[model samples]
Target: MFKVLMIEDDALIGDMVKMFLKEEGFIVTRKTNGADGIEALSRFNPDLILLDWVLPDMDGLSVCREIRRVSQVPIMIVSMKNKVAERVDALVAGADDFMSKPFSMHELIARANALIRRSKLSIGTDADFNAPTLSVSAIAAAPVSAMKPAASVEVPAEEKIRLDVNTRSMRVHGKHVDTTYSEFEIMKCFVNHPGRVYSREDLLQTVRGIDSFVTERAIDVHIANLRKKIEDNPKEPKWIRTVWGVGYKFIPM
Candidate 1:
């Protein structure tokens, strides 16, 4: 059974959500504050987290960042804050999905299931990626090079980038590059389809899946951050180039 750690302040809402999830065969541990919820990280080691934006001690964004420091567990922000900027803040703070208050229980369950499934597929035990699921056709011709044994491959300096599906790591110019989960996903998509233009919406769906809550503008933030890590000059990126009013595309070396 999938374990869910829910951090919600309202007792009535917490009970309702827990009961609903339990009915769906999910094992849920509900906490009324951010501190206890954060502690559950090691104690419960849940498969997913359903976090409330308003907490007794700290805002949900801080809690989200703290959890992200140690775990990549899928987080769904359950908040009454429905504004676009608030949703964008949650995504930027490392949340994988978001749902406003007074939401449909059925929709919440569906989104929860989707998040868990996607997380499992992303970090599957297999040594190589299931490229078809990721729509990685451009790199399909060179699967060996793109998904090589994590430890054995030593990419030459001339090679601008390399990906290790097992480690979820990226190396640019033969140097290990540190990237957030979203940034890495975006980069993976770009590398897979070199030279293909991707609108912000396309890139947003790539990282957050179909149940994404953030706007397309959030993709711009992710792309800018990615350029900083991978490009020699983020201001005038060489690989991730903008296509004027349309969107962005990757120019593989």
Candidate 2:
């Protein structure tokens, strides 16, 4: 079973979330304060974390940053702060995903499952198998010899784009890039359609998977982070270029 560490101060909300997750077959551990939350990290060794933005002892962002210093586990921020800036801050602080207050339980479950699926794929595990030639009974069942040498494969000279949607992971220009779940979704959208100039509203709706709780500036922030990871110099980006008064486009380089 997948283990989840949930740091929530509100008892009712905590219990509700925990119960729901447990019903979904996840091992849920709850902590009421940031200090205890951080302390539980080592003991739980959780596969994922559901962190609240405001905790009694410490802010969730700081906890996220500290945890990221030592671990790469997926973190989903459950916060009431719905501002675009706050969301960007959470992402910058190392949260893999974010959910605003009063969110649907279904949406929360979907996001959590997405993170877990992506995490499994990042470790080279195939969660789904459809190939007739390959039987994936387990992640361990896939032989290393059957894997393709992706690093050595020559990306087309036109523009190189790499994506592993299952993991929400990406690499550009031969360098591994760290991205939040939303940012990865945005990048994946652009990579799938290079040279397309997408308006901020379009990108926000497409990447966020919902039309609510996002702003144009939020899209800009995600683009900036993507540039930092994919560009040789963020100040003068080549892959994702600005469109002056318009929006942004992937230059496919």
lDDT of 1: 0.79
Q: TM-score for all predictions?
A: 0.81, 0.66
Poorest 10 consecutive residues by lDDT, candidate 2: 131-140
TM-score, candidate 1, is 0.81
Specify the poorest-scoring 10-residue window by lDDT in model 1. 129-138
**Which residues of candidate 1, in runs, are more than 4 Å off?**
125-160, 171-181, 208-210
- Which regions of candidate 2 deviate over 4 angstroms? 35-47, 67-74, 100-107, 110-175, 210-212
lDDT (tens digit, per residue) of candidate 2 on 177-197: 666656766775566556678
